[model samples]
Target: MKRFPNQIIRLIIPFVIIIAGLLIAKKFLVPASFGKLGHFRADALGEAMSKPIHYVGQQACADCHDEIVKKKAASYHKGVACEVCHGPGSAHVDSPTENKPPAPRDRGFCPVCHSYNPSRPTGFPQIVTVTHNPGKACISCHNAHDPVPPHAPEQCGACHGDIARTKMASPHVDVPCTVCHETPTEHRMNPRMYVPTIPANREFCGKCHAKDAQSAKEIPRIDMGTHGERYVCWECHYPHLPQVYNGAAK
Candidate 1:
């Protein structure tokens, strides 16, 4: 009593076939346990459990590496698991001599975490691998296990590397770090314990930048009282590379 147009029938035939194909595929392809645990497969948990466990816990690694574990526990990498760098350690734990975990000795490997990514949280240490001691490995200058919290650095750049590198090419390049930062003698050996004091007021920067200052004329001048009177100099101008602001060089 009812019939579709030839064009309508053409579309309907393919649609029906596609639907039938999908139903057939689902019947044979989908796991039987699917939807048993609300969009999850109940068998998936058992399947995963049946697989050989590749990673032994951190405590297992520490059993034979107590000294290294202790050093790492006190360093910047304290939170980083040993397996993260050394690969799955279960085999090594089971057969210590025969199944040694691979050590990532490649210089390229370090940039995975150390690369200068702006999206990283503020104050997280980063470096541009291409320009930062290009010929050398990271472990050359810094020990991987105990990078900062345990090692006593002889220079400020050892800890404040990004700042030091920026300042190296800045107008204040010749200026001693002590000129702007009243660094304690102990700061070099124990940086975190003895934090250095930074410029607190515009007047501190005005020592050299003030229009009426008794300093080199080649240096840029600004009336600290009238220009940016409310803000500290470093608030708008980073002390490391003060000439640049909001991506423009002043």
Candidate 2:
């Protein structure tokens, strides 16, 4: 090979020296454990495994609070785990006297799962806080362990006696109050002058009675496409007494 020119040799020497210096530094500077687990430190897994567990689970809590567990079993909250609202119980279990788990009395506690989030399943009971119970604590109206009310029908009748009586006399007596009136959870907690708005649109009535092939045949169904779109369902047939003659003679 022909010898490099003096200018080229000067430029090449520094690059070769710099690469060699980097390799030497890498050999000494990098930790021995690094790259043992695909660029992670091998000892990190051991350190994490050595740390103590924080959550003791619902079973561990049931061992000490059998009475509360029994009460919960009979209530609507039976499916909810104790530790979900109570927090991790391991610290409390280890030192029961000193590390008592705090009571979940805050108004915000129940709404964590109960608040009306659109992503939540449609069947889950949820409420809009401002409309449901503006300033009241949940525990004030709802029992902590057994949140569901006992006499719902009677409670509803107390305020809406006229509507309740009309509903009872109507053909749709078997239909539940909640079928038309969404539970006014806020109104129950704190009395309000206005109740939740009742829908009078054709689509609202169509939910149960639309003449879709999929709808239950035992119940009345109407074809909105052919049926006069100008008139609402209640205009001709009173919702509470749909079977009774209330409209003008045809």
Candidate 3:
């Protein structure tokens, strides 16, 4: 019995000392930049993090940003979550001025989740390449929550009135404007949507005008040589007047 008491006392003393040491260490220990367990602590901490400021959910935005929200609702991104595009905004909401979070103000921050490339929410493969700056972030040229498609005409003639007039009356009017001037992509304006191998686009026109083509036996073959290889057939055949033989008429 006497020996048992001594053993119990010894074990309890060490346990008490260990608990005391832990208490002291806990009191003095400063939080790490990423907290005590680093990445391990992130998940638990993330749950407790500050909410967002701007897109206080789609409903909140819909209340104030009615026009923008309406436009976005009609876009391909209607299914995407507001936070998915805007990022967490609790800090900004809690102390909007004191924290002055970047989400509300900058494009770079928006890229974190709403990447310029096809991110999680923007799941469409074609939509991924629809960025002015794919290397940067989604927010660079776009407001992720309220994305807008490019309005600029894909054709060179859009700005060049003379070319526009000539092409409008050219025989090649059947062709799409984007077929020549605009870069090839699944989606317009998105660089990532570009096809790695777009076979000879000019050859498309050759398919129709075999009689006027270089290989044709009828009209003395016009040897454009290097120029023909590089330039589209539409460059010579006015789009507005595709029937008019700009080259040696067959």
User: What is each predicted model's overall lDDT from 0 to 1?
Assistant: 0.83, 0.79, 0.55
Instruction: Give candidate 3 regions above 4 Å deviation.
Output: 1-65, 86-102, 113-145, 149-250
lDDT-wise, the better of 2 and 3 is: 2
Tens-digit lDDT string for candidate 1 (81-187)? 99999999988998899988988777988899989999997556788988998988777777888776334567778777888999999878988898988999876
- Global lDDT of model 3: 0.55
Ordered from best to worst lDDT, the candidate numbers read: 1, 2, 3
TM-score to true structure, per model? 0.51, 0.45, 0.28
Kindly indicate the candidate among 1 and 3 with the higher TM-score.
1
Q: The CA-based lDDT of model 2 is what?
A: 0.79
Global Cα RMSD, each model? 7.9, 11.2, 15.5
Clashes of each: 0, 1, 21
Per-residue C-alpha lDDT of model 3 across residues 35-56, encoded as one tens digit per residue: 5565455556666566434445
